[model samples]
Target: MKATTTSAIVLAGGLGTRLRSAVPDLPKPMAPVAGRPFLAHLLDRWIDQGITHFVLSVGYRHEVIRAYFGGTYGGATLDYAVEATPQGTGGGLLLAAQHLPADAPFLLLNGDTFFDVPLSQLTELAASQQTDWCFALFRTSEPGRYMGMEIAQDSRITNLRTGMEQPERLANGGVYIVHPRSLSGLAAQPDTPLSLENDLFPRLLAAGQRWFGLECPGAFIDIGIPQDFHRAASVLPVHTAQRTEDALHH
Candidate 1:
């Protein structure tokens, strides 16, 4: 199946406080990996997956990104949602979403992380379940670092945990297919510094929103820390090229 959701919102506004020692100049996403801006690798993969339009939710040295990839890259139309102040992930997404059509379902990705999920499968799951949100999940023993999720037999997300409370569980991959209607309520809380992982998702889950999860087999890399940032220099180019190769054969 092909992915119908071709537009995406990339959360690219991270301050990269932990990574400032290594990547002092650029925003987290623009930090160089494999001789190219890290964001370029991300966009290249997504564009290969059929994403044609992107709304970058950027702040904290966002100009570096804007000046670098103005309007378009990799055949995708690029748009910017500049945050006057630092809006966290959820708030930045809410701001960027204004650029998309009201009813369309779109992909959401973390700019600092690369999860090589099959975008078509994400859209397929959402369409089949008639769900508002579908998360691409990965099994992780180190759940302390990421959001731990409990998924039911039917793939409905039943619970969420913050830390190692649930070790060796399915963790959020920072990749999702989300409909705008599911996030419409958040539009009201524009000024609040809402986090997609820490704040908004928990609220939506409690509200009995239609949320599901699918475990994906893919290379997942988060360059939020210095170690991973360095690791990406070796991992990203090979993994992304493999992705393009896999896409071609399929």
Candidate 2:
């Protein structure tokens, strides 16, 4: 991998249905925070991580992101994969991957979420001879509201458990380093809706391929629902969602 390859694919296509009550007129990432669109801060985080290029996958009201950010963001080149229909996370990712280089591993971040983990570290892991997919794991008390994940002692993900009844578990941090070749199966067929947590990760895990998760302890938050959206509006101006653990049970 070249040191200059700081490209990333941002999954920004989600409709943000749950957040509509709070940001009814705009896309989730376009929601106002600190007098700017929430995505601006996210782009700042990625740009700070040495990412020089971005391929944003956008659907519902994508023009909002385009009109606001236009072609450049924080010194990084901005591009978009405008989805005419609503594709799930994985499909959106696949669409955006076409815009990235075939040989380089790309960082993936949820547009509506921010986790203060080092993006370079994830890419470092991905550059290894064996690493294919790498993810950041965050401990959350409200695992039910997010995707529950389990990583073994060797850092191999054993399972991504779902539902609200499970014990204290690490939630998917919505940050990843993914290789375009690693997702060939999903990329081959487009528009069929696939999810990173519910679909892609499972197939990767079952295949016994090389994938690992870094234990990233720092500010982590997803403005996916109204409760967290309100909480973020207050906390984001002064701090990123840094916590030892989130015990608030969403």
Candidate 3:
């Protein structure tokens, strides 16, 4: 069977309280890193992989994001799903579910982290594994601060941070290719904040849902803190240059 065209849902709803001192006026996704909005870099990379549609899940200062990116960027069509209240990652995804097709797989990414894995490779890995869900895992130099994923020898994600299962060392890289049917059990609640990591994933594991992890060797940086933001900015330029050189050679 031919691979299906992919659509991306970028979870851009966080208030960004941690980086507020540095970027008080804009949403975290709109925060500047290396001269342009951090999201622009992500979009550029994904567009290179042939992603033509994007659904931005926006909440705080959403108007600013809409004003800046408008309907499209660099030929990719942009769609917005605004959340009236703060919704967790799972909630944001559920809200955007209506925009995605039920039979196709779609990409979901956190707004604050940059995972530089090749999009084509990630998509291929997801399809080849025939898994219900796939998460990109990064072997971080320091894994204490981040949420970790324990993967078995067969490359299946055994558990996330909360579980007691132990396996090879790998951390969640915050990029995912999810089959729409895998989320069929998630129901929106009134007051509870649901997280994909803490809530849905554990249940999926219990139910024997196939969740695989793909290791990302490229730079994975989180822009949530002040120092991390600085580090990302410093690293991104060099990373982009290297990618350009590689593309030229290929």
- In terms of TM-score, which candidate is strongest? 1
What ordering of candidates by TM-score runs from best to worst? 1, 3, 2
Q: Model 1: per-residue lDDT, tens digit, 1-250? A: 5669999999999899999999998899989887678888899889888999999999999988987788877668999999888789988999999999999899999999999998888899999897888999998887489988888999999998778555488999999999888987666254678788888888888888899999998988999999989988666645435333223322
Model 2 Cα RMSD, 1 decimal: 6.6
lDDT of 2 at 37: 71
Q: Which candidate tops lDDT?
A: 1
| Clashing pairs for predicted structure model 1, backbone only | none
Model 2, span 1-250: residue lDDT tens = 4444488888898999999998898999988776667787787776766888999999999987888777776678899998877778878888899898787777888999988887666666667634677888888776368777777887767777876456567878888887777877667245477887788778877887777888888787789888887777565535354221111211
- The TM-score between candidate 3 and the true structure equals 0.88
The CA lDDT at 140 in model 2 is 77
Question: After superposition, which runs of candidate 2 have C-alpha atoms over 4 Å from their true positions?
Answer: 1-5, 188-191, 237-250
C-alpha lDDT of candidate 3 relative to the true structure: 0.80
Clashing pairs in 2: 219-241, 219-242
Error of 3 at 33 (Å): 1.0
RMSD (CA, angstroms), candidate 1: 4.4
Reference-based TM-score, model 2: 0.88
Task: Assess the local accuracy of residue 221 in candidate 2 as a C-alpha lDDT between 0 and 100.
Answer: 72
For each candidate in turn, the TM-score is 0.92, 0.88, 0.88
